[model samples]
Target: MHSRHMSIVIPDTTADAVYAFAADPDNLPQWAAGLASGVRRVGDTLVVDSPMGEVTVRFEPTNRYGILDHDVTLPDGTVVANPLRVLAHPEGAEVIFTVRQRDMTDEQFEADCAAVERDLAALAAAVTV
Candidate 1:
């Protein structure tokens, strides 16, 4: 029910390259520090070792466009849909993430937004490096 969005721009990179990297769930840990660790594939599932515990991440099927939407299933079985996208920009590329402010306190929501910013920064650094 909570709807918010955060984004970052990656310089000197094409949307194609950015999507190529960001679209892969296995590359999440390198950028998403909140996950606490990298993801590994178990059959068709991508599992992440998060601070809250193991979480399952399911990404949309691959496409030429820069859509990187995914679903995160928490340990408690709550599924959070994360709408993410990469778009071509004259400056290079832009990565956007939607932050849903579910039942959390205002402070918690702020922290979540901050975490998304951090993750986007990490992603920019990883791709630009």
Candidate 2:
């Protein structure tokens, strides 16, 4: 169960602001490339059009602690929990995403890491104070 923590600091943005923006499912497609195709709400469920097919995404309830954790249910019924956070930083806000190497090859894990980096970059660009 190896994991890699990747982060990006959003300059001039408060942790609260970043959390508020990123925590919303509506903003996922704008920043999260994996969900770039978009997401739809079907009776309280968030269904994302992913490369792997239609997956369900359930996020943690909104909180002041900056937790943006979510569970992604794949088409095959496998649930993958992704832990993410927006922390207060001197520069502004720092967003961290943990990439777990669950049942993945080294190459797959590396690609996942790179994808997370791009997502964080997109998040940094999308979040504004």
The TM-score measured for candidate 1 stands at 0.94
- The count of backbone overlaps in candidate 1 is 1
Candidates' lDDT values, in order?
0.88, 0.91
Clashing pairs in model 2, backbone N/Cα/C closer than 3 A: none
What TM-score would candidate 2 get against the native?
0.95
For each candidate in turn, the TM-score is 0.94, 0.95
Q: Model 1 lDDT vs. the true structure?
A: 0.88
Worst 10 residues of 1 by lDDT: 35-44
Q: In model 1, where do residues sit more than 4 Å from their true spots?
A: none
Top-scoring candidate (TM-score): 2
- Per candidate, the number of residue pairs that clash is 1, 0
Question: Model 1 clash pairs?
Answer: 2-101
Query: In candidate 2, where is summed lDDT lowest over 10 consecutive residues?
Result: 36-45
